[model samples]
Target: MPIMFGRTIKRPPWRQCKVGSRDDLQVGQALNNKVMELQEQDFNFTIDTAFTKEIRVERLPKGFKMPTIEQYGGTIDPEAHLESFKFVMLFRGASRRHHVPSIPLYLEGLAKSTEWFECLKPRSVSSFVQLGRAFIANFMSSRVDRKIMANLLAIRQRSNETLRAFLTRLNSEALKVWDLDPIVKFQALRSGIRDVELKKSMIMDEPADMHNLFSRCEKHINLVEVLAAKQEKEREPEKKN
Candidate 1:
């Protein structure tokens, strides 16, 4: 028995073989046979004590359940999938080491079979950030049409859409356009309004900035809600009669 890392490793049977007075050729043959036998046997052992002490493994809390992430295939928007994956990982309090390795488990279809092979290479992807970038690059064409300034400028409040809903839609579109200019945003805000009074008010006295613009919009939004409620209350009596 050999003591290793405070554990006993049983010596292989080859170590106990004795060499009698055999000829030189016979001795070499016997030695070669023993070497081959040693190579064929399995030696199961733990890591060195020093290495085991240096690294700490994190465990999930007892009875904790992992949320199921939607599987990403190459056909869908890669950025959206990546964002959702990141959100779930953050919620779970996953570590950086867990990030890169764990993302592969959620991938399937073309994403797992093809894009994954192209994106991850031993030397190429070391971290989750790098993997995300590579993944997006590989599936960039699958993403929906990228929003531009023209798209923002073309936004219009629909006839039935409330001012609050219109503003919410506008804001969502605005977020998709990268490095948006404040002037362009203000112009979009002004152009998208359908209400005659609100449009006239905005044109007569242009907002100083986005803050002022939203403040004006907020007042109108609240006023519209109040007037609508009052009208509904008045109509109730007529309906009852």
Candidate 2:
């Protein structure tokens, strides 16, 4: 049976892709139409569209975890073999859709690509281990260690923004570069690694510290702004001596 299964996404992402003005006229109209279609029962689009072959997903880090139907909280395909699906999705671009939230997008792909799902077989544990080894070897072979280091340290150019803004901007860039160079995609994976690390620390650390790290960045920024304003005021003398 085609293991591919997922739902439609007509909302949740509206905020992320909100229409602003004439600046984004075409894309905005498209998004608006998608929302309206889903809202109006006329929408026949399925959110997921990935052709799945039984592939194995490596042990997913906690945050990269997808939803399963069994989870009362969200969907998780214990049978999902996420790594395989993820690799294919990355290798062969998925059928594009908008408004689908993070994990659900994945499920939508499965739901949409029943034929693709039919061809896949669950990978063996040994084969997966070999693939991991091969992956490291292949990755390392492409360039010497120094180049890898250079790529690792090279940060993308983007202005400072809140976490939400950062994600939106990051997603836009990711879509842009997804095909031109896999490096762009690789960079995104690295960011996911960063996110997973933060989550790990937050879950393990004391609540106060977690809050401090998340909230402190902005708070410190505000404090700097306040202090700078105060300094500027001092430089300007009042009319009365």
Candidate 3:
């Protein structure tokens, strides 16, 4: 199925009705009751949205910009997509931020991010949807995590190439996915902005895991037993007695 975009809000067809406070929504059946009350109070305006309007959401274009909250006359604002990337980097620390993509051999696009971070974990339909949207959006925007994903994806294909080369291919493939210029991927890769590893393709394009392997840190990280190894090194020279 084609991916859908945008918030789907079904306008209620009913006259103006009083909606209880947010606390009202906490009740198990308050929502249904409130809807009933609204319908009873204003039958004319209250209409089922599924029947009234057919809202279809399509995928967003590359570099598609959303209007800032000022356009909506709202005080609150959503965080820029770039901020999310920074948070991931900051959360991981500066040194660990700029490393080559090191995705696990298994896991797919989202499961990796979800598995690693409690904050990023998707426990509900809403959360799952939110995470998915962020992932796709990030993928489209050429975040360094893109290289991490590409590495996982390349490994799945079993191509005899290092992640660096795989990312070059993934960047190429991302262009195709978003219907952008093929050369854009090449240019970005070569420019060192979107570039990952420096190796050339040893094997042609193939499937790979491509999960949980995103990073924008220019620094490197050891995916293999890094935690315990770091701890071991931290000890005082094994306390030579």
**Prediction 2 TM-score vs. true:** 0.22
Please write out the lDDT profile of model 1 over residues 90-123, one tens digit for every residue. 7887755456556667888877764344323323
Tens-place lDDT per residue, model 2, 1-241, is 1233575545444344437645457667887897766544522233221211222222333444343322111133222333444455444443211111222344343333334222322222133333333333322433222223234324343445434454454445554331334444444423433334444544565234423643643454466568779998987786346
lDDT of the candidates, in the order given: 0.73, 0.39, 0.34
Which 10 successive residues of model 1 have the least lDDT summed?
A: 44-53
Instruction: Give the root-mean-square deviation of each candidate in angstroms.
Output: 11.7, 24.5, 22.7
Of 1 and 3, the candidate ahead on TM-score is: 1
Candidate order, lDDT descending: 1, 2, 3
User: In lDDT terms, how accurate is model 2?
Assistant: 0.39
Task: Please report the candidate that would top TM-score against the real structure.
Answer: 1
- Tens digits of lDDT, candidate 3, 33-88: 77666544423222121111111122233554332212111121212333444344
Deviating ranges (above 4 Å) for candidate 3: 1-182, 193-197, 200-241
Question: Where is the poorest 10-residue window by lDDT in model 3?
Answer: 47-56
